[model samples]
Target chain A: MLEIKNLHVKLEDEDKQILKGVDLTVPAGEVHAIMGPNGSGKSTLSYVLSGRDGYAVTAGEAALDGQSLLEMEPEQRAAAGLFLAFQYPVEIPGVGNMTFLRTAVNAQRKARGEEELSAAEFLKLIRQKAATLKIDSEMLKRAVNVGFSGGEKKRNEILQMAMLEPSMCILDETDSGLDVDAMRLVADGVNALRRPDRSFLVITHYQRLLDHIRPDVVHIMADGRIVRSGGPELALEVEQNGYGDLLAEVG
Target chain B: MADTAVLVAQVPTVEGKVRPGQAALAAHLDALDLPRGGFSRAARQDAAQRLEAMGLPGARDEYWRYTDPAPFNAARPEPLEFAADDATLFTAIDRLHLVFVDGRFDAAASDPLTAEGVEIESLAAADAGDDHWASGLYGRLEAAGQVPVKRPFAALNTLAAADGLLIRVTGQVARPVHITYRRSALDADVHLHHVVKLEEGAELTLLESGVLGARSNVVIEADLARGARLHHLSAKRAKDPKLGLGHIFARVGAEALFKSFTLSVNGAMMRNEAVIDIAGDDAVAHIAAAVLGDGNIGRFHHDDTVFVIHGAERCESRQVFKKVLKNGAEGIFQGKILVKPGAQKTDGYQISQGLLLDEGSQFLAKPELEIYADDVKCSHGSTTGALDETALFYLRSRGVPRERAIVLLVLSFLADALDEIEDTRLREDILGRLEDWLTERAGNPGKA
Candidate 1:
């Protein structure tokens, strides 16, 4: 469902290369996890795929379902079924959470030439989805992520993912700041949305989150390249020791 | 030579050399052909004298530094004969309609001026007697407001008003009085002066909307007695090359409440000045304005100058102003809160903000607080900033289009000022108008 070929990204203002000659692919109906030490360009990889500003794609191609994602605008990418669950959700002071979700949902639908959801329909759907994530109407009514706890913001992002129902989801360190209970809830939310056609690229430094979501494949990323790929047990091998042994062996 | 010197000596001496625009105002006043002996001849003569002495504001004047008053003093534009389509802004509730065309009352289009506990009289039909309630108020507040500063345009309006109304409310008014000013003539220059007096415990709401005229000068003087309340809202939407100048002078009595809000959009040049006096103890007053101006270079300008005076103990005053400028549009906000020596326990808050859509746009704000009272709490803030890039990115990443995301952020920037509107329905109406304006601009490239 997702493909990246020789992806090389550099900071726009500086001559610093963050992603260097990386290749990865996530097939449909499969979950892929990328685990690496700090400064391995894990977050940069996720950002490059999502089309964020301040990063120049020097030489590479990123495609989703045979369509060139790099050529599309950010919103177009979202409409094309690319969802990024941000590690730190932005705090929008005046845009209410509910209003934000509804606008996003309708905007994507409109971009795809689909009939917009009515307000009542949106409210009902959002309420049912929010209930499972433990988000109350009060949080939904407040400004988007303003004064929200770490867990609430993550859950809200997941709720958006559920509502949009993207085909390719990128979870960028979604478990970094979450407690055990919050992580369990988030994992449950993601697990529930797992389907035959949906795929997830889980990027993290720890293997704890993968325990709940259960990735089908694991790749050890180092020096802006995928160093190795193996089954789920590869995660356990690193967890038992550390990336020090792997980094030494790769060098 | 001796005779000429004597004649020149007889002429009044101004503070400085008369500006070209100021010298032309006398000629313009002659063309207006003001009538005599309507409400207060003395008030008219005093105002005319003051206008001549003060002259028109010049670029050098401190108060007029940011805003050029030349257009307002220039020759009036030829009338716009475009008939107003049925675009009603205040659809929240039914209201008593009053129509003015080219600054003249349109009796055929207006509803009959009749309501329980309210006596409304047109300035043309007002009793000329000195004992009338309006006589004491015709231009009294304007004169009183000029103590700390001078407003020559307000004085001009008072001196040469062609038509307006006098309203007296002694009880609760269920429906708001909606005044719609229409422009039917291309060469119309309108000067209207209105007076409103609310008796003790009375309540009233005044709603104003429309394009007043090609060149218009309007003054509204309201006096609220003890425990009385007045709500005033005006929505001014004028296109390019038209000029609108308005002034409001209100006196809030003991335990009285005075709240006023204005929404301005798409004017070549527009200035709304509000002067409020909290005279009685425990009185409350709030004045807010939201202005949107988008046009070519030097074509759009909006100025909101507000002054609130606290004269009694424990009085409260708030001034909130927000402006959205795009495409070289210019916005100016000048507000002051004054607490008198004996007016202790006064609570005053002032905030002025501007959101410039591009580098070409400009915003200038001067927020002032003068407190002679020792035991008062007063704060003021002013800010000018571009849209939050992070917020914009967040919205866009969530699938909202770039244009819609900008609109949402702009609306959020204006949310605090809109909350000052006491009525939710009316606030929503204003919000809807803003949204429509933004949506239209969104479709036009290079506007955002």
Candidate 2:
């Protein structure tokens, strides 16, 4: 469902390269986890896939379901079924969360030649999806992510994912600021959406999140490259021994 | 004596007569036949003298530094014709609808001037009767507000304005007074002066809408007595490129409440100035304006000058102004909060913000806070910025198109000022207009 080949990205204003020739692929119906230490270009890879500006892709390609995402705008990529759950959800004042969600849902549907959802229909569907994430009605009525707690913001992102039903979902540090209970709730939301046609690329520094949403394959990323690929056991190995031995072995 | 008269002019003496750009003003004034035998003959004479002394604001004036007064100085503006298709807002509500065509009161189109506890009469029809309630308030507030700052346009309106509404509210009125202006002639130049007086403990709401024609001047003087409440809302549509100028001079009495909000859209040039004086203790005054200008057709400039005075102890004042400019549009905001001596415990808040859609657009804001009272609480803020990039990216990443995202952000920027409206239905009505403007600008009617 998602493919990346020799992806090299650099800051637009500076010569510093963040992602250096990284190659990875997650086939349909599979969950992949990319584990790395600090400065391993984990977040950069997610932003590059989502088509954020101010980043120059110096080399390689990224495709979603055989469609090149590098050429598409951020919103076009979203309509093509690529969702990036940001590590820091932006607080947009004066825009209600419910309205934002409805706009996003209808926009994607309209782009795909689907009929727009009525307000009543949207409200029902969002309520049902929000129930699973435990997001109350008050939170839905407030401005988008304004004054929201870290855990609430993550849950809201998951709610969006459920509503849009994107084929490829990239969870970037979703568990970074969440507590134990919030993490469990988020894991439950993601576990419910797992299906045969959908895939996920879970990027995180800790293996704790992997315990909830177990990955079919684990890739150890270092120096902007996928150095090793293995099963779920690889995450446990790294968690126990840390990345010091792994970096030495790669060197 | 000639030298003394020149000294009285308070400028570089060229002659006994303080004439700078009075040629154009004199031509315009010569054409306007002054109404004879009114209650404010002396006040009108004084204002006319002041207008002569301080000619129309020039490029060198301190307050008119950012705004060029050349457009408003034309001898006679060539009317720019426009067909307005949008229906007048707030028509469904039950209220006294007074219509003005080409700045003249259309008695046939207006409702009968009769209501319980309310007296409505046109200044043109009201004779110079000493018993008339409006005679006292005709030009009282306008004259009082000219101190420390000279508003020549308002002074000119005080003298030449005859076709305007005079409203007196003695008790609580259930219906609002809706004043609508319609332009029938393309070359019409409208001048209006309105007076509103609320008796002690009275309450009333005033609604104003319509697009004044080429080279128009309007001044509304409101006097609120003790414990009275006045709510004023104006939605000025700019369908054509014309020079629309307006001034609001109000004196709020002790324990009275005065709230006013103006919504102005695209125009070639527009200026709305508000001067509010909180005279009574424990009174509250709020003045806000939201402006949206489009420079796609031609040069668009809009200015909002607001002055809020906290003159009594424990009085509160708030001034909120927001502007959205796109495609080389220019927006100017000059706001000041003044707290007089002995006005302790005065709470004043002022905020002016602008959202620039592109690089060509400009926003100029001058915010000032003058406080002589040591125990007062006053704060002011001014900001000019583009739409938040991070917020834009977030919205786009969620599948909202770029154009729709920008519209949402722009609306968000103006939300605080819009929220100042006291009525829900009126707020929604104005919100709809804003969304329509955004949709038209986006050129995506179906999507936006």
- The best candidate in terms of TM-score: 2
Instruction: Assess each prediction's global lDDT (C-alpha) against the native.
Output: 0.87, 0.88
Candidate 1 residue spans exceeding 4 A from truth: A37-39, A220-223, A228-245, B1-22, B75-86, B127-131, B446-448
Q: What are the chain B TM-scores of all models?
A: 0.92, 0.93
User: For residues B1-448, what per-residue lDDT tens digits would candidate 2 score against the true structure?
Assistant: 9998878887665776645568767876877778764666766787888888778877788988888887777667776776673546888788888888889889999999888878988877774554467767777788888888988889888888867888889999988889888887888778898899999999998998887677789999999999999999998876567888899999999999999999887765888889999989999999988888888755689999889988899998998899998888899999998899999999999999989988999999999989899999999999999889988999999899999999899888888998889888888888877887776778742221
What is the fraction of true interface contacts found in candidate 1? 0.64
lDDT tens digits, residue span A1-251, model 1: 99999999899999998888889999998999999999999988888788778889999899999889988888999999999999989887767888889999999999999999999999999999989888899999999898988998899999999999999999999998999999999999999889999999999889999999999999999988888888999899899889999879878
- lDDT per residue, candidate 1, B141-216, as tens digits? 9999887888988998888887898899999998888898887777788889999999999999999988777788
Candidate 1 lDDT score at position B14: 61
User: What are the TM-scores, per candidate, against the unseen true structure?
Assistant: 0.92, 0.95
lDDT per residue (tens digit) for residues A71-116 in model 2 = 9999999999999998999988888899899999999999999999
Candidate 2 vs. true structure, TM-score: 0.95
Per-prediction interface RMSD in Å: 1.1, 0.7
Worst 10 residues of 1 chain B by lDDT: B78-87
DockQ of each: 0.65, 0.85
